[model samples]
Target: MDIYVLVGIVIFLALAFDFINGFHDTANAIATSVSTRALSPRVAIIVASIMNFVGAMLFTGVAKTIGGKVADPAKLEHGVEIVIASLLSAILWNLVTWWFGIPSSSSHALIGSLAGAVVSAEGFGGINYSGFTDIIKGLIFSPLIAFTIGFIVMWLFKQIFAKSSPHQINKGFRTGQIITAAFQSFTHGTNDAQKAMGIITFALVAANLQSTLDVPWWVKVAAASSMALGTSIGGWKIIKTMGTKIFKIEPINGFAADITSASVILTATLTKLPVSTTHVITSAILGVGSAKRFSAVKWGLAGRIVISWIITIPVTAIIAALIYRVIALFM
Candidate 1:
């Protein structure tokens, strides 16, 4: 097959992955608002879709990082094939976890798959240890930071509103969630949509169609549009898990979680690092729940979620590696 043809296929697959990511991670943006009844599902989806599109178009630093960090696309003989395998493996893992209503990280899936596919094609020596470790550090620590920030934010909320009537406070935060949710969705767009753009640009670079890590405008538009469309479709299953599984979310709690996670995510975007919005938002919710009352959280469910987080990277990496070997048979 022509490398150009393969590049075309990669483009399609990258958009498809973005679309899947849109719905798959959509829950991260709107779950709290929907759970708290701050916004109806229909309205929430609309808001998220628009904000995600806008956010996706506004940045490309993370895209550049993703394009060049895992392994230099220019250095590989079968770079396009590796991209195909990586996308296939990432998409497969995403769908599997989505089917089970697990809020797994699309970021991890893509990063792991890219690493696995690269190693499969060029051996461990091909991997960019410094860049890979920097990305991994962002992914691992962002959630912990989000959790701590969420706890402090909730604690502050409690302290400031302690004298207020509980009913009135809840009512006010319920309305405030509208703003936070929109902001959350925007930040989600900025970070999550860029991953697909990065992969597509990586493919372009690998195929010798481009010279730099710069993301083309067309790439950004395609990625952002795909993500917005997927967000419009909504992911009700994950919504249920994020909204009410780990803890029963109230308006105040939702507000705290949304703000904390959004801040962490947006910070990562600005720093050109890819972090898991799912992990950050989920951990933020757990922290808020804990601040509300440690005993009130369902620790079993939180444990299950953490387990999923722990396993996603290794599992997806192995899957991508095997898939790459199978792809090599035909190539």
Candidate 2:
């Protein structure tokens, strides 16, 4: 394939991955608000779409980290092809998880796929151990942090509202959920939307069209637009899983979960680290549920979700390595 043609294919696939990510993770942002009747589905999707775009347009640090941190795009012999395999594999995982209504991590799929493809193409030496380990650390610790903070936040809310009427507290918190939902969606954009941008930029550098990791203007617009459009579609199945299955999310519980997850995601973005919005959001809900009443949480379902998270990296990695090997036959 001509280099230009290959690059074009990579760009297309990257944007497609971004689009899938938007809807796959959409539930992370609005499920709580919608479940609590703080915002209707239609209004929630619209607000999430707009906020996602705005947040995507405003951040590039995460993109830079993704482009260079896992593996050096410019140093590989077939970096563009590695990126193509990574995108395709990640997209496949996202779709499969979405179909099953599982709240899996698109971030994990992408990062793991990219790392696997790089290793397949260049051996273990292909990876920048320092950078890659840092990324992994961020992914590993973020959900734990979100869970802890979620517990504390919900604990505070419970104490503060103990003397108040339950109905009155819920009525007030329902209104507050709208703002937190928007912020959650915006933070989602800050982290998730950048994954595709990074993948595309990785391809550009590998193709010799760019020398630096700085994202181009057109790339930003295209990625932001793709994510916004996807967010508008909504993912009702995943929304059901996230909003209701884990536990009963009253307005106050929803508020605490949203605020906790959003803050964690935004902090990760600021540090130029990519965290799984799915994990953070779900963990926050779990933490809040525990604080509300430990037994009320469906521990069996939560255990299954955790199992999926544990396997995503290795499964996607093996899948991407196989994909790269298949592509190598043509090369």
Candidate 3:
């Protein structure tokens, strides 16, 4: 196949992955607000869709990191094919997880798929160990941080509102959740959507159409638009899992979780690190639940979610590796 055609296929696959990610992970952003009745499902989705677009357009640092970190596209002879395999694998994993209402990390799927595809094509040395480890560290530690911050924030809120009546406190926080939800969605776009941009930019470099990781304007617009459209579709299955299954979230719990997760995501974006919004948001909710009342949280459900997170990378890596092998047979 011509390099141009392969690049086109990669572009298509990257966009499709972005679109899937929007619904798969963006559900975490609006789940709390929708569950608490802070915003209706229709209104929340619309808000998240618009904010995700705006946030996606505002940054490129994380894109550059993703493009260059896992492996150097410039060094691989079949980089475009590797990227195609990665995107396809990631998309497959995202869809499977979404169907089962698992709040898995799209970041882990994409990053793991990229690494696996690269290794499949060029062996383990193809990986940039320092860069890959750094990215992994970010992914691992960010959730722990989000969990801690969520606990502290919730604890503070509890103390401050200790004298307030439950009904009055929830009423006030329900309104506050709207702003937090929008912020959460916006931060989600800034980080999550950039993975697709990074993958596309990686293909561009691999195809010799670009000399650098700097994202083109058209790439940004296309990625942002695809994610926004996907967000509009809404992931109701995930919404149910995130909003109500993990714990019974009151308006106050929702507010704290949204604020904590959004803060962690925004910080990661600014630092040019790709963190999983799914992990952070879910961890935040769990932390808040623990702070509110440890027994109230369904630990078994939370454990299952954690197990999903733990396995995402290894499973996606194997999937992408197999995909690359299959693609290589054709080439």
Displacement of the residue 250 alpha carbon in candidate 2, Å: 0.2
Looking at model 3, the pairs that clash are none
Candidate 2 per-residue lDDT, tens place, 54-81, comes to 9999999999999999998889899999
Which lDDT values do the candidates have, in the order given?
0.95, 0.95, 0.96
Least accurate stretch of 10 residues (summed lDDT) in model 3? 18-27
TM-score, predicted candidate 2 vs. hidden true structure? 0.99
Q: Least accurate stretch of 10 residues (summed lDDT) in model 2?
A: 190-199
lDDT of 1 by residue, 235-321 (tens): 999999999888889999999999999999999999999999999999999999989999989999889989999988889889999
TM-score of 3: 0.99
CA shift of 262, model 3, Å: 0.3
* lDDT tens digits by residue: candidate 3, 200-289: 999999999999999999999999999999999999999999999988999999999999999999999999999999999999999999
Residue clash pairs of candidate 2: none
TM-score of each: 0.99, 0.99, 0.99
